[model samples]
Target: MLSNFDIPLLLGLAVLATLGMVTMYSAGFDHGSRFVDHGRNMLLAALILFTVAQLPPQRLVQLAVPLYTVGVVLLVATALFGITKKGSTRWLNVGIVIQPSEILKIAMPLMLAWWFQKREGQLRPLDFGVAGALLLIPVGLVMKQPDLGTSLLILSGGLYVIFFAGLSWRIILPVVTLGAAGIGLIVIMGDRLCEPDVDWRVLHDYQKHRVCTLLDPTKDPLGKGFHIIQGMIAIGSGGLSGKGFMQGTQTHLEFIPERTTDFIFAAYSEEFGLAGVLTLIATFTFVLMRGLMIAAEAPSVFSRLLAGSLTLSFFTYAMVNMGMVSGILPVVGIPLPFISYGGTAMVTLGLALGMLMSIARSRRIMQT
Candidate 1:
């Protein structure tokens, strides 16, 4: 049964993993140990992906409730005694310091897919409300933990499940319109909304600063706007063909902070230029399109929801990272999928791809 797994999906993951290793090596430069760590992470991720892919989709659905319950408990634990770093209490020490929210990133989609599977062919407006509640609970908690980026990613993932579960655009359109109006209102009242002493308590200081910076980076050009400014400069300097690999002054001179992490795209662009950027984007697009095709061909509602959500979530990661670096959006710390340096993120992505492969393989078996 396991031998019937989707070769294309596996090949795609292999290609992305290879690209990640090469990019990580370039980003690490003199710190060869970082590259080694990345390799170890990729190996572990591949193992997890292969193991999980062997499980039938029904088993995945069965594990959803337990995974969600445990994830929520861990999130609560994080709130009580989680480690504080850079002014956010988002990590829990359970033999290893892990961010509980990352668990929700996977678990939320699983839980939602399970819910939709149970109510298959009978979904209604109230069902969507329940799903929304499920999504909001974790999102609200993460945002309070001051992790805006992860919270948004989780929200996007769960929403994708809801969307693919046959949500009507009639309902979606109004919500989107209202959300746009709300953002416009906030921007209109930016100064007062961000004042030191006010009753508007919807956002944290750093989060507010990010929005303000996005609105007018020139206001704090040398201080709060430094990251965006430097990132834009690096991207602009890349031109059409770029300066050449390992010859990026902005990256090599260490002018770009977080060059190997959140802002790695800027460093990559500075070195590889527009052509490289297009290639990277195209790779991500291929992965997303393939995942969607897998979702479409899934044998069950659970697999379809899960696979589709994971695909969109991957897109969200890339979009957010590029948007932040280009100064068009807030500086949310979303790493570029399969490119940016991180252990947990890579594992999460691998798990998502594995699910897609499982769905594809299951479809093939059913057709046979």
Candidate 2:
């Protein structure tokens, strides 16, 4: 089974996972179980990846619609009968607690790729309109769960598929401009708009607070801003060469929150510094580039769209996590790909890698 796998991509994943274990060990000094749990999740995901890679793209396409439908139905059920924990109705307990929004991350690209493949040659406004409807249904449900990070990922994943299927820049440019304008407006009105008395109509209270905290972490240094401040401090203190492995003071002192999960990048920086950061970035770049080449050479349109979208989805997840930790973006529930210590995310990433493997393997067979 390993013989059929894409060696370069697997090697890149291996390096990232090794980096994750080292950082998790240093960051989880107090909680020994976290290190073990992280390792278990990685191994579990590896097994899943191995099994999934055995299937070809056609079988995956056959599973797409049903999987997407089930995922959305579960999301709706969750809306009606989901368990609320810490004020977020994100988990469903069907004998075991699971987050349904995570399903959308993979399902979005699958469903969209299938939709476009079916309508391959005769795409029109109606087709794009139908695609948008398909995308928004689950994304809207996830946002209703108030899980903004997952919602964003699903939206981006679906959008990537749509874009690959030739969504015109005539429509894309205006949306991009509007997004830029919206960011500018937020920056300009940061002080007044973030006032305690003001109400953000669209965003949840905590979500609004996160944006405000991003703009001015010093305003609530001891409260809402602590995570960003500490993350940046850990990053800055790393300087160039780092403080040495397992000796990150910020991580040891507990200033960096969720050190084995969302903020693991900071802990990594404090120990490995700038050189390690560049190396990690290069490894991810290799994975992304390899994925793009595989997508380009895929034998079918569905395979191409699915593979390309999954690659960009990984990029988006990693970029958002890094940006938030670097204090350039608001804190979201996103975790660094392959480096974050969560079972579900590791599995999702594994499924993605398996899809890439299946796509790349198809190309190799065609050439041979």
Candidate 3:
């Protein structure tokens, strides 16, 4: 129940949700019922969190493999027969609309945590190889669906589990070095590599465009670069003091696109400025720290890894969204956690936090 939830975590989430509502109200500009619907989504998400929290961590571990198995099967079905909209075939029409990749975000960590727990102290390099294979399968499917943002989320969540389970640094270091080197090379050869006629074989046309736009948004001001250019302008125009609530000129004038979704942070920044942005960051940080505390107190390896991965996954989600909006990263469809308005993303957040609460509650019970 709600009574079992950690107090500080709850308070921080409450403040963030309230702030989301305020910013959403302004973002909507009374155009539709988005503010009210967002409130409804929050309520529904809370109910899910509370219900899921009632289960013990043991129960969650038990559900892990089966949930993962089923999620992967669904992804396969989605691949064969899925709805295609906006040039991406990510959703499946199984009686209702379903995006299977979202399942892997939670399932990936659950499955990995359980896998490591089963192996326990008998760990070997082969086990890590097997784990990497497991992570890659679902991630590869999601990528084939061409949903870069969700793929990253699943990849990160699974990798976090592998990381927290004491995977060797020798393997981790090389991958990190390669990724950094790849980024540096891209920047160095951006002029030639990012040309209009050039084909970045690894990425789709739109994906390639986003990377180029990130390097220099002004190149295609009225086309692909428009979103990033406008987002930065809105953020910069806000200044330190902001334009006051409902007073963001860029937002009100419709210069900042997608003000209620992926780019909502820019609208919020335009309205509340640097001070408000700092407050949001602080609240998110508090939530992450409290989550880590719970992870540390968990009784079992499965519980600890599951909790820790979920917590850090939230950090990744927020950072990616904020980075994309700020022009530091390519624009993707990742939402800003509680601050972004989306029912599906809200449910994912609720499930993760609810499981964290369940782990924390189990620890408290054990202590007594």
Candidate 4:
């Protein structure tokens, strides 16, 4: 078990976790025991990572179907009977409350990788269609719950698996083009489309507001735009060298909202500045590259697909969180990986890295 560890990946994770704790200490010092609880969550995640690294790629493949099945069932159950908080019904009350959508973050990739592995040689367009269907079930359920952030994460995970499993750019490029065109149209027609009486039939009112607000935050600077405006202010105030640790005026003065969770990136930037943000990015890039390397050298198709998807999931999480905090993207409630104080997200990340480690371990055994 000790020998199975990927030292570089472990080191990168250690750095991120340490940063998370240090930042959380300053950011959440006044929020009761949040700093201590963040440390505890990191320990719990480490324990999970260790336990999961012991499992082989073959064992993971075996568990894929059952795990995905259970996840989908739980999503349906949540839809039927779940806890409603902040107008979203995402958590299911089993023995304890659990967000069913979080399960799909890992299970989606696992199931897709398993499917592709089984269909190794006999691939067809129908297979990809089936994969999309599988991906959309939980995604649609989560969307219905109005948890767009989790749904997008889960969707990205499944799509990565599909893309790795021989998806052609021919089928991908048109969708990308269409999405870009839609964004352009929105930018051109922002004022008219964002009017109070105007109805965007596809998106919910809140979702539409997020997009419109992202386009022009000053439309409601103190309302919907407050998060983005303050986040940008903090990031800009940090300049090139930052104000040093525990000295973030915006964070300490409570100007940066959700400083301990979704918006922690803003708080981190205010104290660490561009230089610190670059260091954080470099650390994440190192871990991401290591995960990709593990995938490239994986002993089996399933391991490769699963590892690649899981690795890219980290990319998605970091990019979305950072983008939203920087005001370049809509304010999606995505956490900044290790830097954010969320036990569920942390544990999910640990599980993902452990799977990558399992694949890395298998590759080493085969090489020997």
Best by lDDT: 4
2 against 4, candidate with superior lDDT: 4
lDDT values of the candidates?
0.86, 0.91, 0.91, 0.93
- The clash number for model 1 is 0
Which ranges in model 4 have alpha carbons more than 4 Å from their true place?
none
| Local lDDT at 42 for model 4 | 93
Can you write out model 1's per-residue Cα lDDT over 2-103, one digit (the tens) per residue?
568877666666776776777677778865588888888888888887878877787888889999999988888899989998899999999998998988
- lDDT, residue 18, candidate 1: 73
- Report the C-alpha lDDT of model 3 over 1-368, residue by residue, as the tens digit: 35656888889989999999999999987558878888888998898888888899989989999999999999999889999888888999889999999999999999999999999989998899999999999999999889998998999999999999998899889999999999999999999998778888889998888898999999999988999989999999889989999999999898888889899999999999999999999999999999999998899999999999999999998899999999999999999988888999999999998999899888877886
Taking every candidate in turn, the Cα RMSD to the unseen true structure, in Å, is: 1.9, 0.9, 1.0, 0.9
Give the Cα-based TM-score of candidate 2 against the true structure: 0.98
Better of 1 and 2 by lDDT: 2
TM-score of model 4 vs. true structure:
0.99
How does candidate 3 fare on TM-score? 0.98
User: lDDT tens string, model 2, 139-172?
Assistant: 9999998899999999999999999999999999
Count of clashing pairs, candidate 2? 0
Superposed by TM-score, candidate 2 places the C-alpha of residue 313 at a distance from the truth, in angstroms, of 0.5
TM-score-better candidate, 1 vs 2: 2
